[model samples]
Each structure stands twice: as structure tokens, then as C-alpha cells.
Target: MAAGGGSASDPLFPPRAFSPQGRACLALGSPDGRVRAWDTQSGRLRHEYVPSAHLSATCTCLAWATGRPTKEGPQRKKRKSEAAESVEECDLLAIGTTVGSILLYSIVKGELQSKLTGGHDSKVNCVRWHQDNGCLYSCSEDKHIVEWGSQTCKVKCKWKGDSGGVSCLCVSPDGKMLLSAGRTIKLWDLETKEVYRQFTGHSTAVSSLMFITERPSSESQPFDGITGLYFLSGAVHDRLLSVWQVRSERKEKSAVISFTLTEAPIYVDLAVSENKEEPVKLAVVCRDGQLHIFEYILNGHCKKTITSTSIVQIATSGKDDGSVPTPIPILAVAFCSDKQSLLLVYGNTLQPVIERVSLKTSEPHICLVRDIQKNLTLKMKTPILKVKTPVVKSETKVLVPGIPGHSASVKSGSSGTPVSEGKRKPGDKEISIEEQLGAMDIDSMKAVRRGGLPQTDSFAVLLVQGLESNDKNILNKVFNTRKEKLIKNTVARLPVYSIVPLLHELTTRLQGHPFSALLMVRWLKAVFVLHASYLSTLPDLVPQLGTLYQLMENRVKSLQKLSRLHGKLYLLITQISASETRQDVTDVNQTAKLVYEEESSDEESEDEMMERDSDDNWEEEEEREEQDVSADKEINGDSDPDPGEESEEEEE
Candidate 1:
């Protein structure tokens, strides 16, 4: 795989997307611009589609968007054939091509819905679907990130940066934040359509971005205090996997935990288990046919870092029998719905294959069991039946690009085509504007303060109100929102006077709801971070801080003891289970031995009985033979006289 070069004959690692709604099927694209949806469980192709306008274009990326029901228009009727296959509830799939066009396909209709074009001038690298709003985001080599309306295929807004063209894009779960990466990574606020924060770490262009979502525990008291955002970024050129923590700041440094891989990774994905005990699993597909998996858990105590506990690497190059892996280049890897197995797509385009690999970790080595039954070959051709699509009256809106932070030009027109404008040297209009502003004097300016009541139901207002009133329910609302941005904004905008009250409310809440220790501690830390400078100046707040510290200390002590107990009990139970298993095996062996001995004893007794019967029969036969011999002696004497008399009578 390492020796191969980028040629037409070489195998292509195309992008793949699994259905988010059901996880029943996944869409895989090929270099020749063909997309195939395969059943995740059965590994059978449900439908194969080619973009209508992309006859010669190459596919670069794929994304599956769950269909959102809208009252804006009636749903289109799916064909009976497609409905029977249960694709009527299927979602939309967005496919990016090298021709700078995005093809939207309807899984229900089994056809292309619309072709979004002219947003990019170069090959599209990444396409992400925001399911919350049905909007589509795509980044391209043209150095622009374009946002397209869901119903209208027109570009809503276009963003460009000078960081050597955005190569990858990631949308936060709430659909409020967007992450674009190239030479540097930039987090964009989707609501404001502005770069919220930027991060610098990877020396080369980033190839993949995945958000690591920490699912809440299913326990009676779930860990509901995950306030920090964590994601993973990897660059093929840099050969590094970086874990980044999203912060409300201007810029940040490299990833918290930087893991250098042996081979350049082509794709990366994160799978969050529903179980709280299971760590967030990350899978990286490397160029050397090696799939590296890292399981990490976010430590709320240290919100900025994740505990990278277990790492397992398996080769995706061998046959399904877990044979010695060949050096075949792997194209892509995806976590199955079960999270315990992986769906791997390797081999060349001519004989492209998809296989499910079940992974198990032992003490020293990871075991891989390839599911031969689910190994699907993607080389088969399914005849494409063209479905007639109704004519959609498209209203193309003129794209007004925003000002560039880096050296970037705004693209305009219906197709999002780049409208080149000459660089203006502070033009006459700008000079006049500056002169008008400079001409205004202090005497002409009057400060105006507009007073209005804040929205009582807003997150910030509710938080402040809750702090003043000590309303646990209101505070729970703020916490239960689970929106990290809202929480941060509320904390940052908290009034200086209410700082003590906020602390008091947090302490009181902690006392009542001890299960929310993580949340309470995190809020306490945030308060200190924001008001550490002024907090010491006020000696009156010292008592409250002390009390809070004591509460946390007690909680920590108890938690430590419980952790030790859990560990000991787990070890003891495991040993007992092992012993019991051995005992059962021993019992089975002894039972088999006893049964064998009983059968042998029974056979020996039967043999002795047969010997006794045979001896008795021999005695009886001897007595009968002696009696017969005496009878024969008598008969012979009589027979001799008859024989001679009969012979003389016959002669006469």
C-alpha cells in the first residue's frame, strides 16, 4: 500500500456516510462518481445511483441527512418498489464531486433531487449536513465554505479564508457551530456566520474533523455536567491525531493530547456509546491498511483533557478468516451501529469490498474476527432506473459574501460564482466615510442609553434570576439545556454583584443534589476563572468559598473510597467467576468419569452371568449325550438283525 502511487489504476479510498436515523444502511461513493447504499446488517446493495450531471466527475465526499418532515410542502409519493424495500422513510444523501457540484439524492425516490453547482471552483473536499436545520455545508479547494438552503438548492452564504482553502468541515451537534480546517482550524458560529475561535496546531492541511460527544449516563443520576466541547482533528501530511477542546476564547494552542500515528490517516470517525461506562471510541483509517482505534473518556474534573485509556490496531488487509494481513491499502473505515464492530472498505475499485470486522481486546493482543457472511462485494452493477423528477422552480438568490479575515475574495451571483473585484486602496467612499467620522467632535456627540427589560425566559436572565431567588428548578433549566454556548455566555455575562449569590446557589445545589458533583465543581471552577482577580479583594466571600471547598473535599473523599470498593469487588467477582467456571468444568469431567465406570461395572457383571449360564448348559448337554449313546447302542443291536433279515427276504 505504501509503495503504490496516485494513479488511475490505484485503489481509491472514497468517502462514506451511514444513515443517522436508523443506522440500517450506509452510502459509499466511488472514484468514478457512483454512490451505492448498502444494508449495514446484510451488506447488500439497496440502490446504486450516479449523479445526473456528473458523468465524468469524480466523487470526493458523501453525507447522509435524515429527512425532516416539513409542513411547507406535501411529501412526495415514493414508488411501490422503493416503499416495499422500506426506503420510503429513507433520508437524503449529499454527494460531493470533483466538478465543484454537490448532488442531492432522495433515498426514498432513488434518484437525484437537485444538483447544487458553482459554489466552489475546485474539487469539493467535504460536505456536512446539519440535521437540525436541514441546511448543507461544504468546503472545497476553492478556499470557500458554502452554506446551502435545504429546500432551495441556492447558496445562502459563502465563507472563504486564506488558509490555503478549507479541506475539511465539521458541524457541532447543536448546529450552532461550524469547524473548518486547512493549515489552521477555525470554529465558526453558525448563528452569526462568523469565526468564533481559531486554533493552530497541525503543520499541514487537516483531512478530517469529528466531534467527540460524551453521552450522558443512563443511571438514575446521570452525569449531566458535560459543558466543554471536545473534537478530534487529523492531518494526513502531519500524521497526527489531535484532541481539541472548544473554548470561548480568541485562539488556542495545539491539541490537549497529540497522538502521532505510524502511517498517515486518511479518515477519522468517533462513535459514542449509549452506555456511560463505555468510553468514546475513535477509529482512524491509515494509508497502510491499518485501522487504529482509541477509546477515551472525558474527565469532567479536568474539562480540557480526555483520558486515552485503550488503543487497539488491526490490519484491514487480510481475508475474512483473520489471516495474516497483506499490505493492501485500506480506503475507509466506519464504526458499526453496535460500536463493537467496524465496517471496513478496502481493496481496489475494480473489486472493491466491504467487510464487518469484530474486534475484541485481550490482555496482550487484540483479536479480530472477520464476518465472512457480511462481506459485500461492491463491483456488481445494478441497472439504474431513471425516475422522472418534477420540475422544481428554483429561485436563485445572489450570494453576498462576507468580508474575509484572511486574504479572501467574495463570491457573488446565483451559482455562487466568484465575482472578482480589484483590490481597493481605501477608495474615495471609504475616505469620505473616515473624514465624516473624523470631522465629528466631542461636542456633537451625545451618549444615549437605551433602557429595556431583558427577556425573563432567556438563559442568562433565568440564570441570574435563579441565583437571586435560589430557585432550584430554574437553575436546573439552565443546566438541563445542555447547550455549552448558552452556559458559557451566561457565566461570562454574569453581573459582578451576583458572583457571591451564584456561588451560594451552586453550593446549595451541590448540597441538595450531590449526584451533580461534576456540574457543581465545573461551575465553581468557571466562577473562579472569571472573578479570580476581584474575588480575593472581598474577604466577605471567603467563608462561602471555604464551605464550597469543604463540600467538594468530602465528596471527593467518599468517591475515592467507593472507587476502591468497586475495584476490589470487581476483582473478587471476576476471580470467583473464573473459579466457578473451572469448578463446572471439573464437575462435568467427574460426571463423565463416573458414568464410564458404572457402564464398565455393568458390562463385567453381565459377562460373569453369561459365563455361569454357559457352564450350566454344558453340564445339561453332557447328561443328554450320555443318555443318547446308550439308546443308540440298543438300537444298533436291533437294526443289525433287521438288516440281515430284510436282505434275505428280498433275495428269495
Candidate 2:
């Protein structure tokens, strides 16, 4: 599985919501009217349900309905095993098509059960399942909605919708009220079959809408002592994201929280957490390939930051393939239940890559943790795709700019026109504005000091874009490997603020290995070299850097003192050696004597020890003097030894 479903097949429009099967399984409907089930955990294809009559109609909407309630009926109580079997059989799928049709398929039965047709004048845009009584509600471009029974697949009720079309819709968790978006968001009463309240703040058509149940921090209490839901909507033209704090019974009391995005928005999702301290999170993906995550407390004070970004660059050196990356639309983005990973889908032309990107965000420095889908095929969407296999002849090790999970063996299709490898058409080098990034934006990020650099996720994504192959596993190795020099060089490339998070990670690693924390010295050196200009301009960065410098200096000075002490100890030992000496006549006449004396042992004082050391020195000096005298006499006797020989000559 090189990537997700995106290859030659185009993605169904963003509004075709996925139905989550058993924990991680997802059911998706394609424009070709194909309803396939996939396991999100392993990226494996599961099932392809054969519908009765929607094979050619474009799939526009999907909804999953479970037949069994929380407590099973009397027939399910025959045995414990029957209760378990009943739950699996209750799951059903409803798919809406562009030709104004709805098809219902039973999962356990493995067959298309029923079909409803000709309810609208135009294409069906949205379909939702009402949990109670197996009722399904659907809306279409004909400005009408029809509620049908899941059993008979017959219309139960009908309501008028927006004048133009129903762009999107969702049923409440309780399945009583309906939320729909088109020109404006309308909340409808299912029982009364009339629009109960209309929320209007958009200057353009609303393209996306969702009703998310607000999870209170303390389950025992309600939000501000009131049970509620949150209504989120995004407009296509103005690119405005609006979130409403909706109370359970008060549509008039709803509060509007809105924001403008950098690019036209594609999709938005709410991420819930179990931890009370971690605020409720929201993620919004734009058509320009930017993902922003916003966290807010219950008080509505929001802290928003850009988490993931997409940038493209052309290869310029011999090691590079000279291939450029083009920014494409992000179809959808969602956070897994763990809140530490992001699964995203984006494939505009050639490369429709679905990536499960790991996140490291606990520390101040956010970085790419790892790539869950290691085998994902990375495609570069560009005019280069118009040729056969787009092979670069250079033996360069550098990675080409493209999608993440860089692939070395991604062969282009056989359908494109063939051309010489090194040749390009005229004006091929004229890069479009969307393909290139502005200089000012990159400069501002580089100049950050006190405020902080880009968030860790964005920085990590930037690092990935900088690489030729988008090989994120190298980042995994850089953090986990034991090689000292490699860690040193890699850490040098990270920004200065990254040290804050890296230090926290290394600190945890330091508990088991005492010496690993010393790597911070190298980190300090890198920060100095890379951010030297900011050191003076940014006054607040001084104190922390100075402390690290002092620590390194102290360690160096201690090593120097130890080195000098070793040299002095070596000289002292050399001065205390013994040599052989010749004896003389005066030495032969000398006599030896031994004497013993008793001394008091009342714990020797410092003074007495010093006195004894002085006495030993004096005795050693005297002994040396006597030995010198004997040596001198021996020398004189050797030179005067000829005196006996001279007397003998005179007598002769």
C-alpha cells in the first residue's frame, strides 16, 4: 500500500463523510458509486459492498446506522453470545448519489437491502441517519429534504431546504434536530418539519458544517451548568470559520465565535481529550495545504497556531533531481483518538498520498515524530508528469521536493508522451506563484527570538520540505541513535528554540545514562554559531545562553587543573632514585652501631609529626655527607696509587 485510495482515482468531494465502523474501520463512498470499507489502523482494504442500483451514480453522501440499541431486546437475551452477535448485524450503511437516489446496504446481510429514487429534481447532496426508529433523512440540490424509513426505504416526511441547495448537513447525537448548511445554517425540528432557527453571519455560501457534542471537563457537571453542542461552519468565498457555543434548549442564546483563515478552507474537525488540563482542540485544513490547530478553554479564550504547512521548492544542485514540488489541496485532515497523530489526505493530480504523520509537541520545540505509513507513495504533482516515467539521470543522493514519504522507485505512468530525459519545453522554468514561497515569510520565521519560532509541527514540516526525499525516518534516527557525532551534526541544523524541547527529551534520557546530558554542550555550540546575530539583537536570549557557557567553561578548567597536577607528580618521583658508589680506606675503618629507644604513643600530634619529619631529613643529610667524603677519598687514593710503585723503583 504505497498510499491511501488516491492514485489515478479522484477523491469524492470533501462532504462525503466517512462512516466509522467498529473502532478504527472506515466506510467511504467514491464518485464511481463504490462503497468500500477500510481499516484505518493498518491501511488495509476490508469490504466492497455491492449496491442494488447506484453503481453509475456519483456518491455524494454517506451515513452509518446501527440497528441495535444500548440494551438489546428479549430475543437477544437467549444467551450472552447472541447479544454479541446482534450488535454486529445491526450496522447498516446509507449512501446518497448525484442522480437523486439513496441506497441502503446491510453489513451483516452482505447485500443491498433497498433503494429510494426520484425524491428531488436534482442531485442529492447530504444524507443522515436518525438513530431512533431507523429513519434516514436526505437533502438535495432541488431545495427539498425527504426523511425515509430504513426498513421500507419509503419517504416518512419532507421539508423545504435552502433556495439554492443543501450543501451539507448532520443529525444531532440525540437524533431529534437537524443541522444543515447552504446559503446559511438552519436548525430544523424533526417532529414539526419546520426550520426552528436560522444562524446568519456568512457573506458567501457555506460549504461545510458540523454539530459536535461538547465534552465537559467534569462529567459530573455540565458546561456552565448547561448541556450543549458546538456548531462549526466554514464559507467557501470569504474563507471564514465560525464556531457557535450552543446550549441545549436555547438557539437564541447561542454565541458566535469566528475567525478568518489564510486560504479558503477545506475541512474542520474537533479533537476531544481525556485530560482536563488540555483544552478542547480544533483543526482546520485549507485548500492551500495549511493546517491550523486551535486550543481553547471553556471561557472562549482561544490560542491558535499553525501546526502543519506545505511548501514546494525546485532542486538546484547536482545532488538534486531538479524536480519541484507543487502545493496541492488538502482534502481532509483528522486527529486520531490519541491526539498525538494526524491522518491527512491530499492528491490533486498525480500523487494522492495519504500520510499518518507522527507528532512531537509536548515540549517547546515541535518536530515530526515519525511516519506511520512508511510505504506511502509520494507523488509530485507537476507538468513533469506529462512525460513517461520522468526519470532523472543524475546519480544524486539528494531528495526531490514532493509529497512526504519520499519514494525512490515511483514510476510514472505509460500513458504520457515520451520525451528526452534532460529536455524541457520553452518557458518550463517560469514557476507559478502557487509553486513558490515568499521570501518575507521565511525571513520572519528565521528572525524570531523572544516571541518564539514557528510551532514545532510547522517547523518539522518545514524540515521535511527542505529534504530532497522527505525521508522522515532520519529524524527518528537523529533522536534515538547513540552515535555522538551524528547527533551533534543533526542537532546543529535545528533552530535555537528547539533546544528547549530537545533538552527536555535528553533530560529524561539522562536519568538512565548520566553522560548523555553532556550533549547539551554541543547543542549550545550549535545555537551560538547559527543564531549569533540574534544574540545581541535579542537581549532576553542572553541569560540562558550565558548559563550554558559558564557550565562548559567550568568543566574545561577542572580538566586543565588535573593535567597540571599529573605533570608535577611525575617530576617528584624522578628526584628520589639510588646510585652505586666506590668505597675508600676511611670507610674501612668506620664502625656500625644500633640503638633502640621507647617512645610514648599518646596519639601523635601534628607538631610531633612535623618534628619527626625534620629529624629524618637531618639524618638523611648526614648520611649523604659521609658517603660523599668516602667517594672523594677513593678518588684521591686511585690517583695516588702509584706512590708504592715509585718507592719500589727508587730502591731498585
State every prediction's TM-score relative to the real structure. 0.49, 0.46
Q: Clashing pairs in model 2?
A: 2-376, 2-377, 366-456, 399-468, 399-469, 400-468
Per-residue CA lDDT of model 2 for 386-418, tens digit only, reads 545465543433333332213222222122312
Give me candidate 2's TM-score against the actual structure: 0.46
Q: What's the CA error at residue 207 for candidate 2, in Å?
A: 2.7
Off by over 4 Å in 2: 1-16, 21-23, 49-56, 67-90, 215-227, 247-255, 273-278, 298-319, 325-330, 346-355, 361-652
Q: CA lDDT of each candidate?
A: 0.67, 0.58
Best by lDDT: 1
Cα displacement (angstroms), candidate 2, residue 401, comes to: 54
Local error of candidate 2 at residue 396 (angstroms): 67
Model 1: per-residue lDDT, tens digit, 405-424?
12222323233322232232
